[model samples]
Target chain A: MDGSLAERVDYQALVLPYARSPDQDAPRPVRHPVVIVGAGPVGLAAAIDLAQQGIRVVLLDEDDRLSTGSRAICFAKRTLEIFDRLGCGGRMVGQGITWNRGKVFFREEPVYSFDLLPEAGHRRPAFINLQQYYVEGFLLERARALPLIDLRWKNRVTGLQPQGDGVLLEIETPEGGYRLQADWLVAADGTRSPVRRAMGLESKGQTFRDRFLIADVRMDAPFPAERWFWFDPPFHPNHSVLLHQQPDGVWRIDFQLGWDADPVAERQPERVIPRVRALLGPKVRFDLEWVSVYTFSCLRMERFRHGRVLFAGDSAHGVSPFGARGANGGVQDAENLAWKLALVVQGQAPASLLDSYDAERVQAADENILNSTRSTDFITPKNEASRAFRDAALGLARDCAFARRLVNSGRLSLPSTYRDSPLNTLDAEAFDGPMQPGAPAADAPVRAGGEEGWFLAQIEHGGFTLLCFGEAAPEDLPGIGGSPLRPLLVVPAGAAPGKAAGLPVIEDAGGLLALRYDARPGTTYLLRPDQHVAARWRRFDPALVHAALARATGQG
Target chain B: MLNTELNIAAPDDFYEALVALHRDLTPEQSSLVNARLILLLANHVGDATVLRQAMAKAREGIGPAGQDATLRTTA
Candidate 1:
């Protein structure tokens, strides 16, 4: 079985041997520490994180080839930070399209323009709009480079059952039906997940009546790279469209289909091109790369995990693509779950730590679903009355400064905190003033402290952060426990106010700038790896904070 | 865990205040407020048998004081 001879064999013959051993006797079966179903962004992300922690992983995907469809395109700042921790941030950042602004148009006139990235912190830019396929490709490349990751393409998970202390996975490969036993299983197979169905979990939510059409095109026209939303293009009354530019010069346009149009007929170029030309104006030339028609739906699984088998990404929840939260949320789910699983598997933390995965991530999924639903509701209003109302609202906002600020800031996609989470605490007096725990302060400059960079320059450390407001010393606050929770770090607030931090910190803005930093005397805020405030306190509440940390790490 | 009363609202006062607030709000404010209200209402309606019936009555429209005359009659 030399390399050249293996390559020369009939492709079918090579696949046939593995295909014959259908019941757990295959060569590569039952050896993996963890088996992840689906090699999409979420699954690959889990593999990357776990492999980095020295755990062997087996990643399976039913597709014969890598995904080419650009299903999801938006990557938020928080998601980019996760990539940074995985050591692939530079490659992804280089390949993604940085979008900082968006334009909203009413008929022919520009009604509003929003600056999505008004502030830059220590990490990468605020957000990037890259094709989802490229992101997965980048992750796949990185995962393959790791010797611990075994990526098996064209392999489908047919049966999953809890076996012994681990789980048994029945996979259908070109060779045959093979059985695999792993310490844990992650189901990232998507909305109609076999794992979820096997566990008998039901996804409950609302399904909209309207369908949407998304097209990726290469065009010669000079359209700005900023995201553009068109409300009621003249030729197609009541229809809406969104235009976004990708890094490779491909443009993605999402059009709201008329309720009466035949989805099959409307997708034809003759019908689609006319609508696009009418909106872009008749003179511009373009080439359509891909087009897809899908009806939007929102759903969240009743539970993300059953015993040792867990679900992530679309397997756990499904959201309309309006807010670009689908893929990003899934990636976050893996990020949140991976570390906890790794700690438990390595015996650094108790098994109970894995329980917080559902507690925290389910809350996040519900939030993502709600945000996407609201964005969809606004974009594709249901009836004539709703459409009219939306139009009037946009028209009114076009002339008002307050309305313009609200519309353009895009506060919805900003990072959110789990203030009330069992893993978090609240500091009533700490995050006071206009800057609260859950939200970012508007246009707050990152100034230089005693350090070289400005405030906010310390957030790039990629671990739990303690931002001490006012003049409190970091040592005076509560100490973090060892092992699983030993990674906590503290720095001055606004270490580099205007610049992004390479590490997280605490700060002192000269005088009593406590009002600005929301600091009250001796308060502290503990931030999670994703930069969300996990816990806070007016004073050093070590007993409660320790309990929270224990609970978050599953030591409880 | 079953705090049904926590999910319940003072229909007469709350509904009236909501209508008044909706009427007085600017379009942008109204939209934002409406979105928040929808989420709040949905949270309370979770897995409740009475939710569908309540939504049906509310959809028929509310009076100036925020109470749904239809809901009052049905109740």
Candidate 2:
């Protein structure tokens, strides 16, 4: 049956207890090509990608309405690229707050301020501070307009039974129970993933001893729009009073509560207002918007996938929010998994490729979790001796430039690559040099013939971007032996590399060798559709790259 | 790299120097410089218990009366 016609087939009619009203009748059992659990960013992204590839998706969420809580506000540059590829990057970039610099304070005084714009090259959008709920609302609206996606709110997945060639899911909806069978299942159900739990995957990590109070307050007094960390003693000695301005006049302030601070006592406006007044001084007036308590936990699932069912987002890993890496990492995971899943469903690749998703993404998640944990540990030290030590050290950095950079980079969220990835080639001598495979530092100018552009812009279009250091032609390197995956144009220095067909390449004047890809190279990177470094090799090893591509496309 | 010159000062001297340096800085510059100092010191202390107590004390001192006393009034 044609996919367009199949999409038109009434799923309600195929299932049991069909009635005039959806609420009056029990949900009818429906079989979809793919069933995704959770309607959050991760699940929705996966659904959108798969649906675009002509796959039918049934997205289930237990919530009766779209989530209204502004959970994640920080969107990294790499995530923005993903949004761009999804055709919604402009919408988000338009609505979000672009924060280029931040200030760190001791008491009410500023110690350092640095711009997020990289020292060189055109700046990719730094970090955006739009509410996560707004992003979800935008994605949901787009997802609903698609004919191939059926988003069911207030429906929860309660049971899973592996059937022949597919899995059967027992869904508990408000109307009643129903069965959903699909060729593949994805769990984006968040940190406490029911899908992951049902599969009995153990999530491993530690919980911190401290708690934090996060509040969105509307203040009348002027506050720096930049992200600021205030480390004052006495009132907030054991706590970090950090603040970031939203798109509007609203400000989000996070106060690190003492380990012994009572949650009930902290939530009271009377208790919080006094602290706000004390910090801002008597002249500043403010109104509390919302308040909540959060504890830091760093954990990742043992594996991202189990058989045909896979996990993405918080279901796979949880990290402290210091770097805003948690949600960004999850979205990247979806980008990595989506294309591979689509290829497999379309019979273009082998299932073994799915293993690389686990291999590559788990490491990325682990790294992000570790970085966030370290950042949190530093910001919220647990002892008085440590506190004094921190104070003195920060005081010393007051006069130091290098120390400031170290602290700033640790807080700034950037893309990280897997240097030793089987898909990437490492420059033996330049290993210590800038262009390390996994380092997200701004790309340097490479002169191929005479033309010039930042290394990132050259590979930003996605797919395998071969950067020839010497005067080597594209034909000289190994051609993509199998699959329809497009090869980008070879950019020679001087002339702007125009998008050839759909594959665009840029040539550099500074002769630099090795290939730089936007996504994980297949055969080389098995490149995730979103151009993050997935894997690599030093030279064109056809056998290995071929095997990798096979695994990535799921042909093997 | 550790600044031997900065690390060699006595605790009270170090605090006094920080106060003097902070007083010389613009408000925007003082906050970041101070926060960075606090982060570095925290890393070296290696004890969470002491850090927590000190932070509690710092918070209390940041109130109106405390801020006035800790900061130089002349500046």
- Could you tell me the TM-score of candidate 1? 0.75
DockQ of each: 0.04, 0.04
lDDT minimum window of 10 residues, candidate 2 chain A:
A1-10
Tell me the tens digit of each residue's lDDT in model 1 across A146-171.
Answer: 99887777678887778667787877
Could you list the chain B TM-scores for each candidate? 0.41, 0.54
Give candidate 2 regions above 4 Å deviation.
A1-29, A233-235, A401-410, A420-483, A492-528, A533-556, B1-75
- The C-alpha RMSD of each candidate to the native structure, in angstroms, is 10.0, 10.6
iRMSD (Å) of candidate 2? 17.4
Docking class of 1: incorrect
